[model samples]
Target: MHSRKIYTNTKAIAWVTIGTALFSLIFASGKFADGSASPLQILFLRYIGGLATLLLVVLVRRERLSAYRSPKPLSHFIRAVFGASGGGALIYASANMPIVDATALGLLYVVFVIPLGVLVLKEQLSSQHFGAIAICCAGAAIVMASRGAFTEFHMAYVFPAGIAVLGAALLAVEGLMIKMLSHSDRTMTVLLYVNAFGILLMAGPAAMQWVPLSFESAISFILLGPIAVTAQYCIVQGYRLASLSIVGPVDYTWLIFAGLIGFMFFGEKPTLGVAAGSAIIAIGGIMLAIIKPPAGEHESTSSA
Candidate 1:
């Protein structure tokens, strides 16, 4: 039993690392697409591609169609809205902001989840959590202030950072919604509805900017859908195989990978402030992960 536990944990760590890399790659792809497509267009193609791929997976696996049914359509729709809006905002930010900065701001989702979880899940927060929140808030402010100073207050630099913060908040809300929905819905059911509503929500803007896709763009879009869906699955699998405290921190590796990709592929670099703020934010997050919640508080529930 001890050996089995060790193996499971090792597998979880590995899967979580892979999942983080995939998520970073997804952000990179969004950055790439930004040059050739608007966020709306990317959203439409991504969801359409994801929906189609998911449907194919279901069909090929002979999964029961009924498994897609959700008891709470309205709640799922809310999730869909949050998911699509957050995704669009992140992609826009990813395109406009330095990749490392974008990735750092996105990490605020973990911090935002603290307040969101309290409000939405009625989860209790301890003094330590409040302390973490304060630190996180300071870190965010520092990052923003640093960016503004570095850019000499350029809107071109500041706007996307602001949007990235907004996206992080939206993603936190989406995470809470997912927790609620998970109580009554299957994972696939939740995902299907997210993409379904995403298609509907993004279709209008996507159509307005409609242009024929080249073969390369078409292939990229097709692959993007499955890649994102697969990353989500890998995350789920990692969490399933290990404790949240063990695996959750691994998600932050996205920032490192994003920085590497940005520098190597996009000629972007991180500033000192970016590094400091990221460190502070990461420290707070790691504390949140390591500190045990009060007993009888459903601490087993994942934060996002």
Candidate 2:
């Protein structure tokens, strides 16, 4: 049993690592599409792709449509709203900011989770968690403040930076909602609803922003959904295979993968402040991941 548990955890870490890398690729694809598509357009394509992929999964598994129904439809709707908003913001930043910086900043969701856990999940708050949150916030500020020194201090950068931070907060809310939804909803059910609602909400803006895309860009846009869906499944499986304390830090590998990809593909380099800030934030995130809540306290371990 002990060896089996170890093997399972090792497999989980591998899956999470792959998932994180794929997530970086997904963001990179968004960055690539930035020139040819609007954020809404990218979001719409992602939603369409994700919805299609989930539908296929449901069909292949011979799962009834009703199996996707959630007891908490309202919670799913709220989760979808936040998920779409956060996703839109993330893609916006991907388009406007360096992939490494945007990816690092995106990790701030882990920081936001602490306070949100307290307020929304009713989880106990400890001094250590508060200290970690403070560190994380400071790191985020440093990353944003350092942006001007490396890049131009223009609204172009400012707007996306603000949106990225907001995206992190919104995603934090989604995490809380997912915690609640997990009790009664299957993973696929929650995902199916979120994508369905996202598609519905984004259709109007996506239609308005629609521009003719080259074959290559269109293919890239279509690919986002499969990539995203696969990544989400990998993350979910990873978490299911192992405890958060074991696999959580592996999720941070996304930033590293982003940094490597940005350098190779976009010739992007992080400034000293960006590097320092990201390190600080990573430290805090790892600390939070290792924290063990008191028995019976509802801690969020969802990687999605």
Candidate 3:
């Protein structure tokens, strides 16, 4: 039983890791599209891409339109709003600031997840795990603050940084919504609604900032659909496979993925503060993953 549990967790972690790595690419793409497209435009194209891919899959599989129906339409709408706004905020923030810092701010969602997990999902895990989460958030804040030194003297950058924080909180709420919706809807169904709503919510804003894309840029924008869909799919699957307490910490991997991509592709590098912060985060994550509950108590683990 123990071995089987380990395998299940390992698999869940693997899926989520791939999803987050791919998610980092989305962040990078936001930066890549910065000068070429507004955040709304990018979000619109991304949702269109995701919706298109999902439609193709449904057609290819001969899926019934009924597969898209959900008992919780309002829930789906609310989640979509949160997801779209949160995503749009991140895209804008990513464009204005370093992708790594934006990514770090996004990582703050995991911090909010613990409390929400307890309140909404009723998740029970080790106190150590909760502390570990705090550690990771502190570290991410340090990383963000360190990179923030680049703008330490620049006052214009402050608002975008604040937007990033808002985005993270919204996303944390969206994550819990996903958990709630998963109880009543299929993953594909949930995704279909979110993407469809994403398009609708972003349409007006996107149209306001519309610009014709070059051939190369058009191709890249279209590709955003598949990447976003797949990444979201994996993340949803991870939640289905493990408790949020387990999956939330792993979400911190976004910083590592973002930092590397920022350095390799954007010629950005982290300062010493980033290194120190990341080390603390690493310690916390390790503790979260490996530590056991005290005697006679086990974590409240659930599959969904």
Please list the C-alpha lDDT of all candidates, in the order they appear: 0.68, 0.69, 0.77
Worst 10 residues of 1 by lDDT: 295-304
RMSD of 1: 5.2
Q: Give one clash count per candidate, in the order shown.
A: 0, 0, 2
RMSD of each: 5.2, 5.1, 3.6
Q: Could you give me the TM-score of model 3 versus the true structure?
A: 0.84
Candidate 3 local lDDT, residue 46: 87
Quote each prediction's TM-score. Answer: 0.73, 0.72, 0.84
Residue 190, model 2, lDDT: 72
Give candidate 1's TM-score. 0.73
Off by over 4 Å in 2: 1-20, 89-108, 127-166, 234-255, 270-286, 297-304
Tell me the tens digit of each residue's lDDT in model 1 across 1-304.
4444556655765766687788777766657876686657766787778888889978997877677887798988887888778877877787786754775677777667656666665666678656765665566556556656334335687889899999988987776675566555566776688778888998987898777779889778767788777776666556555444445445555655665677788987877876786677567555555454455633122322
Candidate with the greatest lDDT versus the true structure: 3
User: Pairs clashing in candidate 2?
Assistant: none
| lDDT value for model 2 | 0.69
As a whole number from 0 to 100, the lDDT of residue 230 in candidate 3 is: 95
